[model samples]
Target: MLWLDLEGAVNVRDVGGIPTDDGEKITRGRLLRSDNLQNLSPADVTYLVDHVRLSTVVDLRSPAEVAAEGPAPLTRLGHITHVNHSLLPEHGFDATAEALLVRRKREEERFPGDPSCAHYLGYVEERPDSIVAALRAVNRSPGAALVHCAAGKDRTGVVVAFALTVAGARREDVIRDYAATGERLHLILDRLRSSPTYASSVDSVPEDHHRPRAETMEAFLEQVDKRHGGVLGVLGSNGFTDDELDALRRRLRT
Candidate 1:
């Protein structure tokens, strides 16, 4: 896990240098995952544009979240390609936060184990097209692709996990990358709490709700294997062609 050390986002990291099954590593700076980019400082902008050379922004945030937050600093810039792929159905974006929470509670009740994992499975079942679109956006990026949602743990994690798995990354390496976000939970939660759009959504929530657990990601991958067959199976069923999948692997792996 290569931390980017950005001033605005606390959970930003390059999903690179992880050893794959066949001994190659995912290329650094090709794929990045992070929290929101709405508060990027001027220096942060310079670092991302000049040093990171980020060319694509795969925003996994809902339409409501984007509308509520308005344009991020990078979105204001003309150079970067912005792709919107909300992992929820179209009507889902219209739901109120209370409604969203109720839906989450219902998912937890239905799944009966890890609430986070259950919600992730919902993401798979509900709007797989958006997830596939996000992956294709990453594959199409001319330079580093920064994939993000509000907190960048759940949505980003699920998408990145798919990409890494498709690229033949080891399961342990995938779980390690997902678990790395727990190290910055406080900073991530604080950033979210500072935002008017997310502060209320997180207030009074349990600590476990905010933190990423390895077990959650472990279970998610297992479900991906059992339920969807695998990354290739999931993406293929969602209309990702063999060429695009190959392009994705080539873009991320060395």
Candidate 2:
């Protein structure tokens, strides 16, 4: 994972240069994973727009989160395409932010053990359509596509892992990218703590809850292979055709 040195977002990184199972590296500047873009500085905007040529912004945050945070700077600029593909259930869109987070935590904690892995799997099992759509957006992007959630750890991590897996990125490399978020957890949490929408949610949760463990993502990939036949199977089952899959591979692989 190549960390993007931006003044606004802390967990932003390039999901490129990952070695595939077939021995090819994912093309750089084609895909990016990031945290919220609600605080992007002027220089940050210029860098992403002018230098990176970011063409698509796939936001994994829920409708409530988007409403609370307001429009991101890129959205206002109107040059880039911003698509909200919320991984969480939209049934609770009207709920308070605290209530929504509480509901999410409860769902993740449903299993006494392995809450993190379970939560990761929930994203696939619960909202496969959104996952498919997000990737489709990436497939259609004319330039680099930026995927992001609130902290760029859980939801964003899940989607990026799925995309990389489908592109034949090494399993260990995918896990490494997911676990890399732990290295910047403090900065990510600090940024979230400053937001009214996320501050209360993070305040009640322990720091350990935010850490991205490799084992969690490892088990997630394992379960996907066991249950869905793999990333391609998940995508196909969720309405993504072979053409779409090929397009995605073309966009990511070198």
lDDT string for model 2 (67-92, tens) is 99998889987778989998887655
Candidate 1's TM-score reads 0.95
Q: Model 1: per-residue lDDT, tens digit, 92-125?
A: 7578788878887888874677888888888898
Q: What is the TM-score of each candidate against the true structure?
A: 0.95, 0.93
Residue 15 lDDT, candidate 2, scale 0-100: 87
Candidate No. with top TM-score:
1
Q: Cα-based RMSD of the predictions, in order?
A: 1.6, 2.2
- Output the worst ten-in-a-row residue range by lDDT, candidate 2: 103-112
